[model samples]
Target: MTAPSRPPSDVSAGVGLAGLVGLFAWLAVCRAWPAIAFHLGLATPLEPLSGPTAALAAVLFSGLAMALWSVLVDKVHRRPSTGIDWTRPRPLDEVIDISITKIAGLWATWAVIGFAYCVARWYWQGQYVFAMEVLGAAMLPLFVLSVPYVLWLDRVLVDPRDGAWHFGAMLIGREACDPEQVRIHWRAWAVKGFFCAFMISILPPGWAELTRLDWAEVFASPFAMTHWLTELLFLVDVQIAMVGYLLTCKPLDAQIRSANPHLAGWVAALVCYPPFILMGPGSPLDYHYGTADWSVWLAGWPAPLLWLWGGVLVALTAVYAWATVAFGLRFSNLTWRGTLTNGPYRWTRHPAYLSKNLFWWLSTLPFLVTTHNVNDAVRNTAIMALVSAVYFWRAKTEEAHLLAEDPKYREYHAWMEQAPTLTRALGRLLGAARRRPALQPAE
Candidate 1:
């Protein structure tokens, strides 16, 4: 009996030691070891700190630990078979291999760098601004939004698959058919999904809760309202532009991984349910703790009606566009994640992504009042700013990637150069009209 129990006892002992080590390291970095001491009921000479300082330190350490775990957990406990190295990805699919590698590598690096910047600062100063705190909470949503933006842009322009974007939709889409395998890997999907959901849900609550803490006098004013309204309009403009991509986009599975690997990233964003939940003060943190108006929206027949509208008018438009791209569009030779050609594709390079961003902003407007206003301005600004950069980056990447796929891309490029002619011409005409000396009759 003693011999049989030894293994179990040893395993528990090892786990306990690791947990203790992690907790100690975290507490030490934040310089707020008192909380841990209190938790353990150990009497300490130091006073316990509270308010933003303590909150900042706690969050900084928590985020840093999460980043490290995110990097390591993927390959842990799995060994490479034969000569294959688990450290180096064995290409599972032809088109996806490059995209996956780039996505994974980028995520590992981004998570580390982004978290490290915060941790190092916290160690030095022991606190961060409420704005940074709010922005930090929105990181997941911003990360989620980054993927499809990268993939769609890459498909449009052409470039080498750098794996920077973690858009993993195609990979998961393929795996969806095999539920058993997906279940096993579901943790990975969950890790990715968790971040996206955090970005969408945590943001509204963070602002709402923070407001209740008494920053109202600091953040409320006409200037604040003006800035928010300006940012809100910018957000709306960006999303409206996104609709064109949604109407005409294709499927994820059909594309080669080498070119458009981050399809999983796109799928992850959508699969986590509609971004609509994040629109108005978000789904309440506590089921019982929601705004009165929101409560009215959620109860009875109205709730079901809103859900259907959100699903059909908003979510389905994007999904349908993705399906159109997957199924193969007429007249366009682009492959899955290929050059924009179908529906809105013929007009603009990115329609679906632009639309999703627009809808997300539209939904979030009601919740952006008062203290959350600052947070909304910062988060939406960052997201839209990043989206704009992604647009140009994907185009350049796609252009380079397509060199081998279709040398005719050069011809396509030249044609596009000339093709913007009509749009450019129209713009010039409008500008000239506006400039023309306002008809003297008006004077």
Candidate 2:
């Protein structure tokens, strides 16, 4: 008779919970390898490696990051897992092994993309080191936040196995076993808290600018008018997205079904966030065209026509905001909430991406239209194209995930394809939103 299947590895087959923690740390390192290389002065901005000293320091930093992971796990583990639910609990060890392995595989898939990027750039020019640095730097936070953050998305007992149930539950407005389940609550709060704070911080200045807009000066000519409307649409877009965000499910009503657990998916989707790669600490790794820059495409139009073009741009952004409203409080950076089939969603599977990309094609100006330097224009255009490709990829991943959890999503998906804009579709969406059941958050 065949021997029982060999356990996956020394850790998965041997150690139990400790092995799971170690496995997570190891996968995290794989994700961060490029960044570590940079710190070692191994990437493009290479320097004299203070050989032994640098090695020692790198070892310490690696140890520290891992220690932080262990600390988080231990603290998260102290509570009774919310994953102990109405269903029969599966064997925790088996679940842990499977979850850890799957998540690790996802992170490794990101590394594969990094390697592919490196090869592409290297073949074009001898830029291996620079390419590695760019990919690694971007991948750093993506991997670090990935394992911990994704625990909220799990629908199975694996959430408890990883001690993520408490924080994950708390994040989606579920009743927590304790108020201070761990510092994860702080992390969760910091995420939404910072978003609100940033939105508020910008409003006063934005509103002031909008009011201060010189109407006569803006109407000087068609090009001038185009510029004014572009700025106006941007101001309005930001406000709507934030307002819709504030209206989303609060803890009292929100129930997170699953989070997007794939590492590449998180990275692909998050690269769209300004803080992730736009105006914040990690912004340097990405450069692309934003909606704000689109008005340049409307240059030379008559004032009336310019207004029309600007109206289209603003309308697309409104679709973005409406998707937020349709989806509701369950709306989040990476988690699954109830699927929305009405509002703009009734018109298209991905209204945000579709409208945003169409806006890009219209606005491919800035460097693309104005620059004489073909190399610079091409490179900039290519990067934005890559960014658009990432969003499309995120849409597919989201579809796959939703379909897995709810066969209803498949039926909904099919219906949208056949009769997405029918009056019946709108009626169904209206009814679903009205009738959607929400359980009370834990007492």
Candidate 3:
């Protein structure tokens, strides 16, 4: 048999890898800032950059690095896929009306989101408080800056009357607008409004932990090393993913071309996030009860076994993080920014989900609980299985959305069916079963 064909990726492995290098480089600088200051003989030593501001700076550093790589190396700005024609400059008077409509739509959307934040109790509580504070402070600047940005962008846009413009026209009733475009507009903003806050809230904690972690102590024990390494990888994922959510600019060639329009897709994705997450602590799908972590259960195991288990867990976490990194600045759930076929995506369709579920199983060891009760073990295992099934449902919905939106994704899907992976094996089994003749009713 001939070898399977390799489809082209929208994102190159080098682009995302460059972003990773930049992210870690900034983190290293933050960690060493105080020392650098002291060596320079400053009046006072600089404090460790481990706060929320530092975390935010990490996002900027990583995004700028990726943006530079995308422009300077990949020359992504020139791609026809960017939906821009920088060579043709439309007169300001020609595009002013279109820019105004888009600005109105964008500003109104932000206002609605702000009102929702005020009404939502969760926004004022716990980790969300920081997110709200950050957004609130940026509100004025965003409002002011958006006017010029929108006006400037409308000039070169191949089609200035995008979804946002359609939404504005619908509200004003001064121009004809497609209902479908309005829906698309709301769906895209809904994703950004909900997820951006969640991503920002989560940023500071993992960042603080990594910055403050004692490297010597971490290296002294296998458990400590694996745990912190996993944490560090997660921090990387969060930082890069946050940049993706926030930097959805057309100029960067990282705009959300379309959000998932299917109701099933939205439902599946929403349930996996906060305020709707079913697997949160004390929620319906909580499966952590009566169970011990891998380290806890393996405390009495041999050193070699402990090391091996720790290594496996770290590897799984790394794969999960790598999946996010592969997206570069275009990672977001339930949106078609671009198709990625490189990095870990080359081997599997959903590397993050696959690795994440495996990590949960190995780390939680739900079947091997501290409590001796068989019922607890059975219940935890069943709940864990259900959680995995939810992710499976999510994957299906996401696939459906992408297949409908992008032909490239469909080609990739077809290629995966014939490739020598577990997904291909499963597909072949299913295909064969479908072709098998059914047993005839007693004739």
Candidate 4:
């Protein structure tokens, strides 16, 4: 008989929670460094880390801390899921050619991404400027480091002929390569290329706001406090997520297993992000045309009500951030790095999407427009509904991808279907609606 199935999650609660603790600890230190320097009687007191460099450093710190926790405490490197066999490393002569091929594939991938960045006008404009500058600076180091890194990693990889190897083989017309592996290689790189820039671009603004804020002023108003806290949570989410994108090492068991192969999945995810976002101002799904925020709509309301509304919004934002934290170092869009079934994930399959949509609706109050035109109100509310529908589509696509890729995810999906959660409830409702026979035409 088959043995009883273990817990459905690949990631444990302690693993992610430990990483969260490490992240917050480092953030606290970064925030306190200037004061610490002043107390030590330095000639030039260290300034608050409010620059883009400092924000990038925060990503490094967060990534390092999470890596330590995963390796030392969780010992994820020993897991079979990593597809690494540290016990039996191959001889250098055996894997050198394979490593060389992989490195060639990797370098060519970076060159293509760099070329795309140069050609894309959006990368040079607005918030993307910082991303381009950071990537440009690191390009040399990344290229130099890949030789040794690939050479070392290939020795222990269970099968070194991964997607990158396949792509390399195809490029040089060497051994036969699977076309599907080449496709997966491009898909994974495309995800990393698009998102890493976007994440880096937005980091500085939030870091600057957080580091420069005066506590006195921030605490003076409910709205101000809520807004500041919300930004802080979002900053945490971005920093952790950037780490996930950068640290796809097998030793940490954070390497992506597969990117979503479905075109619908890519379309669903890309439309929600830069260069293709439909919900931005003046875009097709723009929902903020005439709607004022909660603060504006509820201005002059009772202080208690203001506090309550602000608190709820902040709580929702916190849940969204927590969903990212739950992934620890495995967070990314359109990739199955691993299964996460703890933290906010225990409550719903898509806590981030659910909380995010709710936050937008509650915060924007699209039904109450500043224009005082019934038409404006109706239009804004309808647009907001469409935005939520887009997220729903994104959720479905992600579920399909994950369900197909990993047995662990399938188990988690089954467990969640039985568990008393909003996802399960919705799943049942959808199942019932589908099962119900269409109304018979008059006989």
Candidate 5:
């Protein structure tokens, strides 16, 4: 009789097998099918390379159409107030609702349009291709269209009365509101929308390639050069995914949001937001709206993946843990338990916030789909660094607000007098140095 399998052993075996099957399936659907059909369709008369190529062709065309539509919408309909109108009484509630509706409508409308566009494009291409051709024709349009819709949605919606995310005065007189809470910025909405749309547009080719059989060759030659140049961008793709995960997954996100109730919205909004959507085996709406893509981990592991996987997870966790612990220490050691702490607390009462921003930057590492291209590496690194810097500024704003909020915080302000400018200088120097590795000695 065969020996009974231990739980851990069985789990490992199951996971590994699942990963292998997923990886191969993804490669076959994304890369192999497309290439084979493209070549075969080329050889067959009246077969217009119908599937993957046609789908790609549709995405390109539909993307252009969507971009144009955005510009046209900007010119024609032009929803006023930048989506989040702070001037409205109890604006937070109103803005939240409108934002939600806008996001949803934009996503749904564009998804449908995108799908239609791809099918039309494929039909026009008039080619015989593999099953992927039909699938791609059906899917690419939805994916492509989500970009612009997301942008427009952010521009049009603001404040719901009931504190739920909703649209304009359409649902007014339904809920009461307090004047005490702060409203979110409208510009932030536009910026976020643009970011989401841009992210959506950039993802398809690489992803579609990865989903097919000839995936390994995606970065093999001419594509390899492109991959290298945009490796950092590919990495940005990864960062986007990880950010989405951290925001959506309760175990990962709850810790951060536990600090403040308002942060719950931020965390939820960020996680499920449209920007991280990459085409694969899922609903485009799920992709465009907010949700986690478990399919990403379907493959067991990339060779040498342990370092990247473990390092990113560990670093992010450490950052958050340190923040929580530091906050605890600050509270426990303070002379007055309820009184505001001094030192780091004075200059920036929330070192945790600063650290949290840094964690976001670090956590993006494993998520970025790195390709073997110098350019890709540089681009992605630069983008993540830029985003990190932006977050740093955002953290500083939070610090400013915190300083203003607590009177006891004033006493700690004196520490800034003794604070070293060298730290910031050293940080920049170290960052630059680390970005470029030491030259390995010749063998």
Candidate 6:
């Protein structure tokens, strides 16, 4: 006979303890790398947050995160149910393994850079080994932590009796979570909740800015109206994207259809966020918004043409808004609900991504900015390109997973892949609409 299954408590404790070890291992190395290098004569001691202070901080931080997460798991596990169905199998280990694997790819990419730096520095007596050492130090910790972090996630998310993830469901005040209906992960909830809180937190200042905007001045300078318009549009879209899913979906428990599983795809998706997205070599994600070169190029044209540019921005923002409307109360990062065939989706596979990226390209405002160092500009350009590429990867990964699981996606994939773009998709839709003929005056 097969060995008996491990007890739930045992499994939970095992994963938690294992993750703690992984966290300790990585944090210890990150804290120790500089001193280790200095002792080995590979580089000088790092002055900023180095040595013992770094060690203490890393230990404290890791300990706190683990301790807090453990407490959260216990609380969540023991919390009373919210009455939704919880009969699905939760392949939590798979989620942990896949997510961690994807994150590791990020570590690998940096590891290469670290090694390249080491190789380059060897010629200069390894003096500037900071790049190599810092990244190199981070790799192992990140990789190791990924395992236990996932395990910890499993402990926190998966319920053996129900075999479903309820962290997200519980937060929405639901006693039970139905994966088939609405799935919420702890990570997504935290992010969505934080942003919603941020928007609410900034409301005072936002209102103050609105109050300060003079409509008279705005009418005299049509451009001035953009201040509030931008704010309004941003506020609406964010509120919907972040909070609507939790509040407005059918079932009253917004179910995230599915999340992406590919390692590279997920990392590419996540680095679009803070901290990691901000991780650049002396180049943070700090930039003011402005019009793109092409938009400025419109200035030499007629006044109508300039007005046309503003309309285009509005249209792009509308496309973004349309997507949220499509998602309604079911939106979450990196998850696929049913394929969208209506509204902007029929127009393009990834309307939001396309529109947002297009908006950014137009708003780069190249004409307004002076020429900068080629290297700096190129690096910035690469970062933007990487962001675009990540979204594209997300679209493909979503298609990959959905097509694998659903015949609906496969059919939709054939249709979307045939078009591969908005123009083509629109053309196809129009042709189909023409063939079907318009409804006669609603009878």
Worst 10 residues of 1 by lDDT: 3-12
Question: Model 6, range 140-201, lDDT digits (tens) per residue?
Answer: 77667755544444433433222122433333443454554332333333333333333333
Error of 3 at 34 (Å): 2.0
lDDT of each: 0.36, 0.48, 0.89, 0.88, 0.35, 0.48
Candidate 4 off by > 4 Å: 1-6, 40-46, 425-443
lDDT, candidate 1, at 186:
36
The best candidate in terms of lDDT: 3
Candidate 2: tens digits of C-alpha lDDT, residues 1-443 = 43232111101111122322433344345335556778777644333232222322322333343334333543322223223232444554545444454355445545645555545433234323332443356578878866654443333342442323443343444344344433433333333433443443343444344444557878786556655665555544444334323432221123344555556766676666544554233354243423235555555667677767666765665666455434432345555545565566667777777777666655554255344567766656666676678778888887877777655567677676556354457678999999999988999
Q: Give the number of the best model, judged by TM-score.
A: 3
The local lDDT score (0 to 100) that residue 290 gets in candidate 2 is 36
Weakest ten-residue segment in model 2 by summed lDDT: 6-15
Residue 273 accuracy (lDDT) in model 3: 85
lDDT of 3 by residue, 305-385 (tens): 999999999999999999999998899999998888878888889999999999999999999877799999999999999
Runs of candidate 2 exceeding 4 Å displacement:
1-204, 214-237, 243-252, 278-298, 301-305, 366-369, 420-443
lDDT of 1 by residue, 1-443 (tens): 22211111101122212322343354343344456677778776444333344433333333333223322442212322111223443233433544554455445555754665466443233223343554467669757875655443343223323223323322434322333332323333333332322322222322222223333542464333323333323322222212212222112111222322244333423333333232223342111112233223333555456545444334424532342322221111112223333344333444544554455444443333334456554655554445434444544444555554453444444454455433355667999999898556744
Candidate 2, after superposition: displacement of residue 330 in Å? 4.0
lDDT for each residue of candidate 4 in 198-310, tens digit (9 for 90 to 100) = 99998899888788777886798899988988998998889888888988889999998899999999999999998999988899999888788999989899999999999
For lDDT, candidate 1 versus 2, the one ahead is: 2
CA deviation > 4 Å runs, candidate 5: 1-28, 34-162, 165-171, 178-182, 185-192, 208-443
The local lDDT score (0 to 100) that residue 101 gets in candidate 3 is 89
**Candidate number with the higher TM-score (4 or 6):** 4
| lDDT at position 69, candidate 3 | 92
